[model samples]
Target: MKKWAIYVVLCILTPAIVKAQAVVADSVHMTSKKKVPKVQYGVASFYHNKFEGRKTANGEIFSQKKLTAACNTLPLNCWVRVTNIRNNRSVILRITDRMHPLNKRLIDLSHAAAKTLGYTGHGLTRVKVEYLGKTKPVELNLMEQPAQP
Candidate 1:
Protein backbone atom coordinates (compact mmCIF):
# COMPACT_ATOMS: atom_id res chain seq x y z
CA MET A 1 0.00 0.00 0.00
CA LYS A 2 2.84 2.43 0.80
CA LYS A 3 4.50 1.83 -2.58
CA TRP A 4 1.24 2.55 -4.38
CA ALA A 5 0.76 5.78 -2.40
CA ILE A 6 4.30 6.96 -3.26
CA TYR A 7 3.72 6.29 -6.94
CA VAL A 8 0.54 8.40 -6.85
CA VAL A 9 2.37 11.28 -5.20
CA LEU A 10 5.18 11.10 -7.74
CA CYS A 11 2.74 11.23 -10.63
CA ILE A 12 0.96 14.24 -9.11
CA LEU A 13 4.17 16.22 -8.61
CA THR A 14 5.89 15.34 -11.91
CA PRO A 15 4.17 17.97 -14.01
CA ALA A 16 5.10 20.83 -11.66
CA ILE A 17 8.68 19.65 -11.56
CA VAL A 18 8.86 19.57 -15.37
CA LYS A 19 7.29 23.04 -15.67
CA ALA A 20 9.80 24.57 -13.25
CA GLN A 21 12.65 23.06 -15.19
CA ALA A 22 11.32 24.56 -18.38
CA VAL A 23 11.23 28.05 -16.86
CA VAL A 24 14.81 27.76 -15.75
CA ALA A 25 15.94 26.63 -19.17
CA ASP A 26 14.16 29.52 -20.93
CA SER A 27 15.59 32.18 -18.59
CA VAL A 28 19.09 31.47 -19.80
CA HIS A 29 18.18 32.61 -23.32
CA MET A 30 16.75 36.00 -22.44
CA THR A 31 18.31 38.85 -24.43
CA SER A 32 18.80 42.40 -23.22
CA LYS A 33 17.55 45.42 -25.18
CA LYS A 34 19.73 46.79 -28.01
CA LYS A 35 19.65 50.24 -29.56
CA VAL A 36 19.45 50.66 -33.35
CA PRO A 37 21.63 53.23 -35.04
CA LYS A 38 19.96 55.89 -37.21
CA VAL A 39 22.45 55.47 -40.01
CA GLN A 40 25.57 53.46 -40.63
CA TYR A 41 27.99 53.36 -43.54
CA GLY A 42 30.50 50.62 -44.10
CA VAL A 43 31.24 47.45 -46.01
CA ALA A 44 28.36 44.97 -46.10
CA SER A 45 28.30 41.28 -46.86
CA PHE A 46 25.76 38.44 -47.07
CA TYR A 47 25.04 35.20 -45.32
CA HIS A 48 27.07 32.38 -46.74
CA ASN A 49 25.37 29.38 -48.36
CA LYS A 50 26.34 27.02 -45.55
CA PHE A 51 24.17 28.80 -42.97
CA GLU A 52 20.95 28.65 -44.97
CA GLY A 53 18.98 26.46 -42.59
CA ARG A 54 20.75 27.20 -39.34
CA LYS A 55 19.09 28.96 -36.43
CA THR A 56 19.61 32.69 -36.23
CA ALA A 57 20.22 34.81 -33.16
CA ASN A 58 16.53 35.72 -32.98
CA GLY A 59 15.53 32.01 -33.05
CA GLU A 60 14.27 32.04 -36.64
CA ILE A 61 15.49 29.63 -39.30
CA PHE A 62 17.84 31.39 -41.66
CA SER A 63 16.40 31.86 -45.15
CA GLN A 64 18.43 33.55 -47.82
CA LYS A 65 15.30 34.43 -49.81
CA LYS A 66 13.88 36.57 -47.02
CA LEU A 67 14.78 40.22 -46.88
CA THR A 68 16.75 39.86 -43.68
CA ALA A 69 20.07 41.16 -42.46
CA ALA A 70 22.32 40.87 -39.48
CA CYS A 71 24.19 43.36 -37.36
CA ASN A 72 26.52 43.18 -34.43
CA THR A 73 24.56 45.44 -32.07
CA LEU A 74 21.18 46.35 -33.51
CA PRO A 75 17.97 45.22 -31.88
CA LEU A 76 16.45 42.06 -33.34
CA ASN A 77 13.25 42.20 -35.43
CA CYS A 78 13.79 45.84 -36.40
CA TRP A 79 13.88 46.99 -40.03
CA VAL A 80 16.64 48.93 -41.75
CA ARG A 81 17.08 50.42 -45.20
CA VAL A 82 20.27 49.25 -46.90
CA THR A 83 21.52 51.13 -49.94
CA ASN A 84 24.31 50.09 -52.24
CA ILE A 85 26.45 53.17 -52.57
CA ARG A 86 27.88 51.99 -55.88
CA ASN A 87 24.71 51.75 -58.00
CA ASN A 88 22.38 53.67 -55.63
CA ARG A 89 20.06 50.67 -55.24
CA SER A 90 18.27 50.27 -51.93
CA VAL A 91 16.24 47.62 -50.11
CA ILE A 92 14.67 47.41 -46.68
CA LEU A 93 15.51 44.41 -44.56
CA ARG A 94 14.75 43.11 -41.10
CA ILE A 95 17.40 42.38 -38.51
CA THR A 96 16.85 38.74 -37.70
CA ASP A 97 20.28 37.56 -36.68
CA ARG A 98 23.78 38.59 -35.64
CA MET A 99 26.92 38.82 -37.67
CA HIS A 100 29.90 36.66 -36.87
CA PRO A 101 31.93 38.16 -34.03
CA LEU A 102 35.11 38.02 -36.08
CA ASN A 103 33.51 39.68 -39.10
CA LYS A 104 34.59 43.29 -39.67
CA ARG A 105 31.65 44.37 -41.81
CA LEU A 106 29.03 46.80 -40.56
CA ILE A 107 26.08 44.66 -41.70
CA ASP A 108 25.37 41.28 -43.30
CA LEU A 109 22.60 41.03 -45.87
CA SER A 110 20.53 38.10 -47.01
CA HIS A 111 21.47 36.45 -50.30
CA ALA A 112 18.36 37.85 -52.01
CA ALA A 113 19.11 41.36 -50.79
CA ALA A 114 22.63 41.15 -52.11
CA LYS A 115 21.37 39.95 -55.46
CA THR A 116 18.74 42.67 -55.64
CA LEU A 117 21.28 45.35 -54.76
CA GLY A 118 23.61 44.18 -57.56
CA TYR A 119 26.34 43.01 -55.20
CA THR A 120 26.16 39.24 -55.55
CA GLY A 121 28.96 39.25 -58.08
CA HIS A 122 31.38 41.01 -55.74
CA GLY A 123 30.13 39.37 -52.48
CA LEU A 124 30.60 42.69 -50.70
CA THR A 125 29.50 46.25 -51.20
CA ARG A 126 29.87 49.71 -49.73
CA VAL A 127 26.49 50.43 -48.22
CA LYS A 128 24.52 52.91 -46.14
CA VAL A 129 21.99 51.59 -43.65
CA GLU A 130 19.19 53.62 -42.09
CA TYR A 131 17.20 52.29 -39.18
CA LEU A 132 13.45 52.26 -39.79
CA GLY A 133 12.42 51.13 -36.34
CA LYS A 134 10.23 48.05 -35.86
CA THR A 135 7.97 46.77 -38.61
CA LYS A 136 4.94 49.06 -38.99
CA PRO A 137 2.39 50.10 -41.55
CA VAL A 138 3.78 52.24 -44.35
CA GLU A 139 1.64 55.23 -45.25
CA LEU A 140 1.30 55.92 -48.95
CA ASN A 141 0.76 59.36 -50.42
CA LEU A 142 -1.08 57.95 -53.45
CA MET A 143 -4.15 57.04 -51.44
CA GLU A 144 -7.12 59.31 -52.23
CA GLN A 145 -7.89 61.79 -49.49
CA PRO A 146 -11.41 62.72 -48.30
CA ALA A 147 -12.92 65.70 -50.06
CA GLN A 148 -12.64 68.91 -48.03
CA PRO A 149 -15.56 71.28 -47.56
Candidate 2:
Protein backbone atom coordinates (compact mmCIF):
# COMPACT_ATOMS: atom_id res chain seq x y z
CA MET A 1 0.00 0.00 0.00
CA LYS A 2 2.77 2.44 0.93
CA LYS A 3 4.68 1.69 -2.25
CA TRP A 4 1.63 2.49 -4.42
CA ALA A 5 0.99 5.72 -2.51
CA ILE A 6 4.61 6.82 -3.03
CA TYR A 7 4.42 6.20 -6.75
CA VAL A 8 1.24 8.22 -7.12
CA VAL A 9 2.68 11.18 -5.19
CA LEU A 10 5.85 11.11 -7.23
CA CYS A 11 3.90 11.26 -10.48
CA ILE A 12 1.75 14.09 -9.27
CA LEU A 13 4.67 16.28 -8.25
CA THR A 14 6.87 15.61 -11.26
CA PRO A 15 5.02 17.92 -13.63
CA ALA A 16 5.16 20.91 -11.30
CA ILE A 17 8.88 20.38 -10.82
CA VAL A 18 9.42 20.32 -14.58
CA LYS A 19 7.33 23.40 -15.10
CA ALA A 20 9.37 25.38 -12.57
CA GLN A 21 12.57 24.47 -14.37
CA ALA A 22 11.37 25.93 -17.64
CA VAL A 23 11.91 29.66 -18.04
CA VAL A 24 11.85 30.58 -21.69
CA ALA A 25 14.90 32.77 -22.02
CA ASP A 26 13.39 34.58 -24.97
CA SER A 27 16.58 36.16 -26.35
CA VAL A 28 20.07 36.45 -24.91
CA HIS A 29 21.08 40.04 -25.54
CA MET A 30 24.06 42.20 -24.65
CA THR A 31 24.60 45.92 -25.13
CA SER A 32 26.82 48.82 -24.07
CA LYS A 33 25.08 50.20 -21.02
CA LYS A 34 27.67 52.43 -19.42
CA LYS A 35 30.06 53.47 -22.15
CA VAL A 36 30.87 52.36 -25.66
CA PRO A 37 34.19 50.65 -26.10
CA LYS A 38 36.88 52.09 -28.33
CA VAL A 39 36.16 50.63 -31.74
CA GLN A 40 38.50 50.29 -34.74
CA TYR A 41 37.33 52.02 -37.89
CA GLY A 42 38.22 51.03 -41.46
CA VAL A 43 37.58 48.19 -43.88
CA ALA A 44 35.83 45.15 -42.37
CA SER A 45 34.92 41.80 -43.89
CA PHE A 46 33.46 38.39 -43.13
CA TYR A 47 34.18 34.68 -43.44
CA HIS A 48 32.78 33.07 -46.56
CA ASN A 49 33.08 29.52 -47.90
CA LYS A 50 35.56 28.68 -45.19
CA PHE A 51 33.36 29.12 -42.16
CA GLU A 52 29.92 28.55 -43.54
CA GLY A 53 27.79 26.20 -41.43
CA ARG A 54 30.48 26.05 -38.76
CA LYS A 55 29.72 26.55 -35.08
CA THR A 56 29.83 30.19 -34.09
CA ALA A 57 31.15 31.81 -30.95
CA ASN A 58 27.56 31.39 -29.77
CA GLY A 59 26.26 27.97 -28.91
CA GLU A 60 24.22 27.65 -32.14
CA ILE A 61 26.01 26.51 -35.25
CA PHE A 62 26.64 29.35 -37.68
CA SER A 63 24.79 29.77 -40.96
CA GLN A 64 26.59 32.09 -43.38
CA LYS A 65 23.36 33.11 -45.03
CA LYS A 66 22.03 34.68 -41.85
CA LEU A 67 22.69 38.35 -41.17
CA THR A 68 24.69 37.63 -38.03
CA ALA A 69 28.02 38.81 -36.63
CA ALA A 70 30.35 38.17 -33.70
CA CYS A 71 31.55 40.60 -31.11
CA ASN A 72 34.12 40.56 -28.36
CA THR A 73 32.23 42.39 -25.65
CA LEU A 74 28.72 43.15 -26.84
CA PRO A 75 26.05 41.05 -25.18
CA LEU A 76 24.53 38.08 -26.90
CA ASN A 77 21.56 38.72 -29.26
CA CYS A 78 22.28 42.44 -29.37
CA TRP A 79 22.40 44.37 -32.65
CA VAL A 80 25.18 46.51 -34.04
CA ARG A 81 25.90 48.55 -37.13
CA VAL A 82 29.29 48.20 -38.80
CA THR A 83 30.26 50.96 -41.22
CA ASN A 84 33.24 50.69 -43.53
CA ILE A 85 34.97 54.05 -43.53
CA ARG A 86 36.92 53.41 -46.71
CA ASN A 87 33.98 53.20 -49.09
CA ASN A 88 31.12 54.28 -46.89
CA ARG A 89 29.95 50.70 -46.76
CA SER A 90 27.78 49.67 -43.85
CA VAL A 91 25.89 46.64 -42.59
CA ILE A 92 23.84 45.86 -39.50
CA LEU A 93 24.07 42.45 -37.91
CA ARG A 94 23.04 40.68 -34.74
CA ILE A 95 25.38 39.41 -32.06
CA THR A 96 25.11 35.67 -32.26
CA ASP A 97 27.92 34.74 -29.92
CA ARG A 98 30.97 35.87 -28.07
CA MET A 99 33.78 36.95 -30.37
CA HIS A 100 37.07 35.14 -30.89
CA PRO A 101 38.28 34.96 -27.30
CA LEU A 102 41.99 35.33 -27.99
CA ASN A 103 41.93 37.91 -30.76
CA LYS A 104 41.50 41.66 -30.50
CA ARG A 105 39.25 41.66 -33.55
CA LEU A 106 36.25 43.83 -32.71
CA ILE A 107 33.67 41.89 -34.69
CA ASP A 108 33.44 38.91 -37.02
CA LEU A 109 31.01 39.34 -39.86
CA SER A 110 29.19 36.52 -41.59
CA HIS A 111 29.59 36.10 -45.34
CA ALA A 112 26.25 37.69 -45.99
CA ALA A 113 27.04 40.53 -43.64
CA ALA A 114 30.36 41.17 -45.30
CA LYS A 115 28.75 41.07 -48.69
CA THR A 116 26.17 43.59 -47.60
CA LEU A 117 28.98 45.95 -46.71
CA GLY A 118 30.84 45.39 -50.00
CA TYR A 119 33.69 43.36 -48.42
CA THR A 120 33.56 40.25 -50.57
CA GLY A 121 37.12 40.04 -51.87
CA HIS A 122 39.10 41.62 -49.07
CA GLY A 123 37.98 39.16 -46.37
CA LEU A 124 38.62 41.90 -43.84
CA THR A 125 38.15 45.63 -43.45
CA ARG A 126 38.35 48.43 -40.93
CA VAL A 127 34.94 49.40 -39.63
CA LYS A 128 33.10 51.43 -37.00
CA VAL A 129 30.43 49.83 -34.78
CA GLU A 130 27.65 51.56 -32.96
CA TYR A 131 25.44 49.87 -30.39
CA LEU A 132 21.84 51.01 -30.86
CA GLY A 133 20.62 49.76 -27.51
CA LYS A 134 18.20 46.89 -26.97
CA THR A 135 15.24 45.83 -29.09
CA LYS A 136 11.92 47.46 -28.23
CA PRO A 137 8.76 48.31 -30.09
CA VAL A 138 7.60 51.90 -30.24
CA GLU A 139 4.06 52.86 -29.38
CA LEU A 140 2.22 54.57 -32.21
CA ASN A 141 -0.20 57.42 -31.49
CA LEU A 142 -3.37 58.25 -33.43
CA MET A 143 -1.24 60.36 -35.78
CA GLU A 144 1.05 57.40 -36.51
CA GLN A 145 3.92 59.06 -34.69
CA PRO A 146 6.17 56.92 -32.51
CA ALA A 147 5.97 57.77 -28.85
CA GLN A 148 9.71 57.98 -28.37
CA PRO A 149 10.25 60.07 -31.45
Backbone clash numbers for all candidates listed: 0, 7
- Which residue pairs does candidate 2 place in steric collision? 30-75, 42-126, 42-127, 43-125, 43-126, 44-125, 44-126
Which number leads on TM-score? 1
**What digit string (tens of lDDT, one per residue) describes model 1 on residues 1-149?**
99999999999999999999988878865653445579989999998899999999999999999989999867889888889999999988789998879989999999999998999999889999988887642631223356669
lDDT of each: 0.86, 0.69
List runs of model 2 lying over 4 Å from the truth.
1-43, 48-50, 136-149
How high is each candidate's TM-score? 0.69, 0.59
Off by over 4 Å in 1: 1-35, 137-149
Q: How well is each residue in 37-59 modelled by candidate 2, as lDDT tens digits?
A: 53545334465576766776667
Clash pairs, candidate 1, are none
TM-score: model 2 vs. ground truth: 0.59
